[model samples]
Structure formats: structure tokens, C-alpha cells
Target: MGTFQIEGGHQLKGSIQPQGAKNEALQILCAVLLTPEKVVIDNIPDIVDVNKLINILSNLGVKIQKLGKGKYSFKSDALQLEYLESEQFKKEGGGLRGSIMIVGPLLARFGKGYIPRPGGDKIGRRRLDTHFEGMIKLGAKFRYNKEERFYGVEAPEGLKGTFMLLDEASVTGTANIVMAAVMAEGETTIYNAACEPYLQQLCKMLNKMGAKISGIGSNMLKIEGVKALNGCEHSVLPDMIEIGSWIGLAAMTKSEITIKNVSWEDLGLIPATFRKLGITVEKRGDDIFIPAHTEGYEIETFIDGSFMTISDAPWPGFTPDLLSIVLVVATQAKGEVLIHQKMFESRLFFVDKLIDMGAKIILCDPHRATVIGHNFKSTLKATTMTSPDIRAGISLLIAALSAKGTSTIHNIEQIDRGYENIDERLRAIGAKIIRTA
Candidate 1:
């Protein structure tokens, strides 16, 4: 396990570039399996989860060549289908949840897909029903091995395209189904699909590779099966979740930082949601400039004088990923707000760690928390804590950076799974943080 020792109460000032989106990269990387040609991708984030997926692909006999920093070429012409049934493959694939996405493309191309139970952050119960059910709708045979905790799908005669209304707009599930449908025969219509920018980018990339897909940014998507897909180059967007985390860190520590190369049009409802907590965000071209909050900010209330509520929903709504950062920033604001994490059951449990750091927070339930801002009247006292998940780890890091004295955080690997070189990047901008093994 690694730990971060952060010395707090420092004002940071500078500019930093946000890393490429992790979520989008996962979907994009898995799509390489859809074609046998070389697919070159740029702006790939150097994070643990992404690297793990790449390693898994290499183990499956996919040829990968590193062209440059954040650039790679993937060709699956030599893919080994037999590796999917190996014990070594199960061990590698079971470590990350993103590995499950490979099932769709594999089933589409090779007529078979198999995966062991995947693992990820302990935030909620993420089920694979949406993915399996979607594939079954397309005429794939599905089976589960209860003793082995494995899932397998096969379509001996090829998949047939059909209309599917998903039980929910699961992002990974939608991406999986779309990848499988592109090679199937006939037309496929998907209603209530996830419309996040990640999914939109996936559709655009698929279209560039000769797949016919419509509805780039809407909940409904239409796809026409293609005989084959050609390889194409794609660049991922900036990580909006990381950008939001930087915004919250700047606000709590009174820092001024500029996040560069952020696709402003793609970051729906994120900046506006932070603005509700009285943080000032300026857009200069493709960059978001966050000024230091010398004068403490206040949370905005409704017109009827009720407490403001910050909750999460699907795309075009506030993202569930940024709610943890919002909850942390609200602690130092001038008013009270209720945070409702509707998507995940246990995401709000990290509030207890924030409360231990001398913030006023009420854990209403597993999915809700009410935060009363301290308004910089009383400084937070640094202490020891363990990070629970990717978002929560960064939230605690921000809290530690804004608190008085030194704080120690254990289990920093959770943070590294998403953010790329977070400690080094923050240090360049005047944050006093050190990683220790």
C-alpha cells in the first residue's frame, strides 16, 4: 500500500493539463477488438486501470506498439481466442471492471466471449445483467457458471440485430451492446441508451471506422450492421472528473489554476453544478481558469429560500462521479446543501472521513448527506484516513490540502487507478504532497 502525506494551508497558482478521460479510453480500447486492422489511439492516459487493460489485450495475442507518449497502435489480427478459457486469462481479466467490456467485441468477431467476475471500487453493486440481457436480445446464447463465477456468451450462427430497450442507461452496458451490434446482420435500434460524452465519442469513432450509427448525442441510437470495420485513429477528450476535482481543490485551498484542453462542449452540466456552490469558473478558449477564492464563497439557495440540493442523474444531468468533490467543497462554503447520490448506494459513506476532519456533515442515509459549510471560520484539523474509492480518494486529498497541519492518507492506489501521476502534477502547481510506500 502507498500513502500520501500532505502539508495543508497553501495557496496554489499555475496551470495544468487534464489527463485523457479514463472512462472513454476504456471503451475505445476495447473497441480495437472489433477489427483486425491497426487502430492507433492518441491522448491515452497513463493510469493503472488502462495499463492493466492493455496488458490483458497483449496477453490475448493482440499486437501493440508504443509510437510515442500517449500514443499506441493496436492490431488484433493475431488475436488468440483460446486464451479466453485459460486460468491466466481469468486472473488478469477479473482484476478490473473495465475488462468486462471486451466481451462485446469478442463475441461479435469470434462468436464467443467469456469473463470471470470483475472487480472495482467498493462504491456500489454494479451488475452485469444489462450487458448480458442486451446481448441475449441480439440472439446470443448466455450462460453462467455459479461455482466458477464466470459468464460466457456465444452466437454460433452470428448475431442478428434487433430493437432493445435497456432496463437502465448503463454506460458500459450500452457501449458493449453497440460494439456487438455493429457486426450483426440487419438494423439495430437501442432506446434509453447512455448518452454520456464517452458513449458519444465511441459512436463517432465507430462511424469513422465504417460503422453506420446515428444519434450521436441522444438517448436513442440507430446502427446498421457492416460486413467489416476498418481501423481508425482517435484522440480522447480531457477527463471531466479530474477537471472537477481540480476545481474543488482550488476552491478549498484558495488556489488559482487553469485546466487546459478541456472539451467545453462535452462537459455538460459540470461547470454549472460547481457554480451553484459559488465557485468562479472562466472559459478561455478550450481552458477553464479557476481563480483563487480569497473571499470565501457561499452556496446558492433556491428562490424560495429552501436549502439547495445537489444530486446526480444520467447524462445532461449532474454526473454521479463529481458529487463526491461537490460534497467536499460544500464543507467550506457559507451555506448548507443536501447531496443526493442517487445512482450508487454507498458513495456517500465517505462523508464520515470528512466529518472526522472537523467538517459539519450529516449522513442522512447510504445515498444522501447534508453538509453545513464551515465558511473558513474554523480551519480543518488534519488527521489520518484511508481512501475508499477513486473519487472519494481525491476528495479526501483535497480536504487534506485545505486543512491545517499535516495529514496522512493510506490506500492511495485507489486514486492512481484513474488519475495519472496526481502527486507529481499537483506538486508542479505548488501543492505540498509526497507519495510514500
Candidate 2:
């Protein structure tokens, strides 16, 4: 396993261009199976999950040609759906939670789809019921084999669009059902769907491919099924998660960083959420600048003027994926803030690690914690740490980079699953980080 050795207490300055949205790229890649024509995608992140999905598609006879950096043209004219049942499927499926998306396109195109249990962060119980329930609502039958621990779905009469409301706002669930519904027989109306920026991009791309979708930015969607779809070129939007990470990193390290090419319009409530912590972000054209060396920052209380409580929720709300980063940044700020990770039960477990490093934090329960800032403490003791998930790994990296001495973070493969070339980018901004095997 690779590990990161970081020499802490150095301010990182300079500019960083955020990578493409990992969530969008995954769905767009699987959407290639919706047609037999050639599709070109630009600004794809070279992350581990995307690379693994590419290998899975290649093994299935999809001709993948890498045009250049962050650019690729894919032709799946000879795609073999049977590869979905191979050992490679198991490996890829176990590595990515988004692999479940293939079940929709494969079923829509080939009349059958097979998928094993998907893998991702162990933050909480990620439900697959939403995906299967929506598929079944659209005239599909499912059979689960206990021995193989896989799910198989078949649509004999073709997919019939139905009015279905998801129980929860699931990101992958919304993508899978939306893909399947686009090729169905009639109009599909999905209520309570997840309409994040990534989902909006997918809907836009599908519309370009001849699907009629309305209410693009709302929780409700109307998809008019099409007979067939042709491939098109699509560029992914900037990753909002990466943008949030940079915001937290710059604030904690007291560094001046300019993030370029940011989609300011898509950043709903993020700036306001960060402002509650007294971090002032400046915007110049399409770029965002975080100042170095904040004078005196304190947490702002709620609108009721009570204690400040930051939690995660559905789209247009603070993201659960970023709560970990916020917790680390809170440790470096001047006052205390309550973090409520409502979506996941286990996401707050990493706060204990920060507490051990001379930061003041109280873990109230599995869902909440109170973090008191380090008050510019010059020394945070370094220790050997293992990454539990992608976001948590990045949080630890932020902590390690701002600590007093050298710290080693193992299981860096988890970090690479999301952030692209973090060490190289950090080094460009004067961060002292080295990769060792």
C-alpha cells in the first residue's frame, strides 16, 4: 500500500484547477451502453474507481481509446453483456458503489442485467432498495441468488414507464432509474428524486441524446421515453466536492489559494454554509480566492440565535461527504461548532483521531460532535493513521499537513479513489508531501 508522509506547518499558496465530477463521469461512462454509437467524454478524472470501471467496460468488449489527458472516446458497438456475470464484474462491482448503474443500461439494451453487491465507503447502511424498487416499478422482475450474492433483472415486455416516488433521495438510485426510464415505453414521472448538479448534467446529456426531460433542477422529473439514443460528446462539470475540500484546506492551513474554473452558479448554499464559520471567500470572475491568515474567526449561531449546528441533508443543502472536512477545519478555527452528520451514523467516528492530536473535541454520539478550535496551537502530535474512506482520508491529510511533525497516512488507495493527483497539486502550492510504498 502507498502512504503519504507530510511535513506539517507550511502554508500552501497558489492556484488549483478542480477536476471533473467523479459522480457524473461514472454515470456518463455507463450511459455509453445505452447506444452502439461512439461517445466522446472530456474532463474525466483519472481516479481509481473510474479506471476500474474502464477496465470492466474494456473486458466487456467496449473499445476505449484514450485521446489525451482527461479526454477519451468510447465505442461500445461490440459490447458483450455476458461480461456482467464474470469475475471481473465481481472485482469491479466490489470496488465501486456506482457499478449498479450498469444494471439499467444492460437491461434496457440486452433485456437482462446482472450485478453483484456493490462496494463503497462504510459510513452507513447505503440502501439498494431504492434502485431495485424503482426498476421493479418500471416493469422489471428481480431474482437474487444466495450462493452468488448477485442480483439479476429482466424486462420481457420492455420497460414501461410508471409514476414512482423514491423513499429516500438516493444519488445512484436516481441515476439508475433515470437511465432505464429514458428508454422505456411511456412517460416516466419521478417524484422526490435527487437533482444535484451531477444529476442535472446527466439529464442534460440524456436530453442531448434525444430524451425529453423536464424539471431539470427540481426534485421532480418528467422523462419521455425514446425509441433509441445516439452517442454525443459531453464535458463534465467541475467537482463541487473538490471545491469544498479546497475551501476547508485553505481555511485550516491559513493559506491563500485561488481555485479556477469553478461553477459558481452550481455552488448552492456552500458559500453561505462556510460563511457561518466566519470564513470570507472572495470571487473574481469564475475564480474563488481564500485569504491567508484569517484574523479572528468564530462560529455563528443558528437563525434562532441559538447554538450553531451544521448538518447534512438532500440536494441544495450541506453535503454529508464534506462534513468530515468541516470537522477538521473546525478544529483549527477559533471557536466551537456542532457537526451533525444526519445521513450517516458512523461518519463522526473519525473525530476521535483529531481529539488525540491535541485538538479539543467531544463525540456526543454516532451522529453528532462538538469541536473546539485549536486556538493556534503550534504543535499537533503526529501519528501513524489508516484511511477508512475517501472523505475521511482527505480530512486526515488536512490535519496531517497542518500538524507539527511528520505523519504517515497508509491505505492511500482510498484517497486516490476520489481526489486526483493530490500530492502533485499540494506540492504546486508549497505543501511538503511525499508518496512512499
Candidate 3:
């Protein structure tokens, strides 16, 4: 396991460009399986999870070529369908949750698709019901091997479109179902679908590829089945979660950092969410400039005199992925804030690591945490810790950078799964962070 050795209490300067959205890249990469023509994707983040998906696609006989940094062209004209049942496929495809998406496209184009239960962050119970149920609604037969813990879907007569309402608005589930619906026999209407920017991007890309999709950026999505889809070039948006992390990092360490080329309109409540924590998120054209908080930031209170609560919800609301960053930044704020992470159960457990470093935090439950800021009057003492997940790992890194003395973080592979060249990127902005194997 590699570790990060960070020298704390150093202010970072200069600007950093956020990498392409990891969430979007995962969906777009899977969409490549829907077409036989050449699909050229730009702004692909060179991270572990995305790379794993690409390698899986390559192993399945998709011809891939590197165009440039963060650019790749993929053609799925030929595919090894037998690979789906191989031991190699079982091991590689089960490594990440994104692999589950390939099943939708494969089942759409081919007669069958099989996959081992996918693995990802052990944050909580992430069931595959939504993905499978949506497929079943589209006239696909679903089967599960309880002994092997494997799942498969088959559309022997090909998929037929139907109207269905999802049990929940799941991003990956929505993306998977959308990919399947684009090749169904008739019109498919999905109600309560996730309208995240990344999902919207996937729909637009499919539209460009000859799929008729409407009701974008809304809860209802309408898809008309196409005989076949062609390839197209698409660029991913900057990762909003990473951008939010940088904003929280700047405020926590009292740094002046500018994030370039952030799609401001697509950010939806992220910038405003950070501002609620007393951090200044200034918009200079398309970029976000966060000034140094020399005097520390103060959390806003409710008008009724209740404590400020930051909670995650569906789109247009604050994203749950950045709640960890908000919780970490609130440690040094002028007031207290309650962080409610509704999406995942075990994500808030990592706050205990911050509490060990001299921060005042109350773990109210598995879903909520109360953070009392030291207001910079007290600096966190450096300590050794382990990363639990991608978001929590970055949050801990931000805490380590703002703490006193030096800190060591084990299992940095989790951080690497999301952020591309994070240590080098931080170094460019004057942060004293080193990666040691």
C-alpha cells in the first residue's frame, strides 16, 4: 500500500485545474459499448476506476487508441461475448461498480450479458436492484446465481420499450436503463430518473449517436428506440466533487487558489453550498476563485435560531459526495454545522479520524455528524491514518494539509481512484505533499 507524507500548515498558492468528472466518464465510457462505430472521448481522467473500466472494455475486444492526454478513441465493432463468462471476467469485472453498466449495453446489442456482483467503496449496501429491475421492465429476463453471487440479463427476442417509474433516482441505475432503452423496440419513458449533469451528458451523447432522447435535465426521460447507434466525439465536464474539494482545501488552509474552466451553470448548488459554510466562492468568468480566509470562516445560522444543517438530497440539492469535505472544512470554521449524509451509511464514520487530530466533532449517528469549529485558534495535531473511500480520503488529506506538523495517510490508492495526479497537482500549488511507496 502506498502512503502520502504531508507537511502541514503550509498555505497553497496558484491555480489548479480540476480533472474531468469521474462519474460522467464512467457512464460515457460504458456508452461506448452501445455503438459499433468509433467513439472518441476527450477529458478522460487517468484514474484507477476509469482505467479499470477501459481495460475491461479492451479485454472484451473493443479496439482502443490513445489520441492524447485524457483522450481516447474506442470502437466496439468486435467483442468477445464469451469473455463475460470467463474467470478473468469474474475477477476483473467485479473490482468496481462501474462494470455493472457494461451489462446494459451488452444486453442491448447482444442476446445476453453476465456479470459477477460488482465491488466498490464499502460505504454501505449498494444493491443492484434498480439496475436489474429497470432491465426487467424493458422486457429483459433477469437471473441470479446465489451460490456464485453472479447476475445476468438476457433479451432473446431483443428488448421492447415500456413506461416505468424507478423506485429511486439512482444515477448509475438511470444511466444503465437509458443505455438499454435506446436500443429497445419502441418508446421508453422513465419517470423519477436521476437528472445529474453527468447523466444529462450521457443522454446528449446518445442523442448525438442517433438515439432520440428528450426531457433532459428533468426527472422524466423519454427515449425512442433506434435500430443502431453510431459513434461521436464528446468532452466531459470538470468534476464538481473535485472542484468542491479544492474550495474546501483553500478555505481550510487559508490558501488562494483558482479552479479553471469549471462549468459554472452545471455546478448546481455546489458553489452556493460552500458559501453557506462561510467560505468565499467567487466566480471570475468560468473559473472559481477562493481567497484566503485569514480570519477563518463562520457557518451560517438559520433565521429561526436553529443550528445550520447541511444535508444531501437529489439533484438541484447539495451532492452527498462533498459532504465529507464540508464536514472537514467546518472543523476550523467560526461556528458549528450538522452534516447529514443521506445517501450512504458508513461515510460519516471517518470523522473520528479528524476528532483524533484535535477537532471537536460529534458522531450523532451513522448518518449525521455535528462539527464544532476551533476557528483556527487551535490547529489540528498531525497523526497517522488510513483512507476509507475516495471522498473521505480527500477530506482527510485536506485535514492533514491544514494540521500542524507532518501526517501520514495509508491506502492512498482510494484517493488515486478518483483524482488524477493529485500529489503533483497539489505540489504545483505549493502544497508539501509527497507520495511514498
RMSD of 2: 1.2
The TM-scores, one per candidate, come to 0.99, 0.98, 0.99
lDDT of each model, Cα atoms only? Answer: 0.95, 0.88, 0.95
Steric overlap count per candidate: 0, 0, 0
> In candidate 1, what residue range of length 10 has the lowest lDDT sum?
81-90
Residue lDDT tens for model 1, 1-437: 99999999999999999999999999999999999999999999999999999999999989999999999999999888888989998899989999999999999998889999999889999999999999999999999999888899999999999999999999999999999999999999999999999999999999999999998799899999999999999999999999999899999999999999889999999999999999998899999999999998999999999999999999989999999999999999999999999999989898889989999999999989999999999988899999999999999999999999999999999999999999999999999999999
lDDT of 2 by residue, 215-308 (tens): 9989999999999988899999988889989988888788999999999998887878888887878889999899986564567877787778
Question: After superposing candidate 2, which stretches have Cα over 4 Å from the reference?
Answer: 294-296, 377-379
The TM-score, computed over Cα atoms with residue i paired to residue i, of candidate 1 is 0.99
Which runs of model 1 end up more than 4 angstroms from their true locations?
none
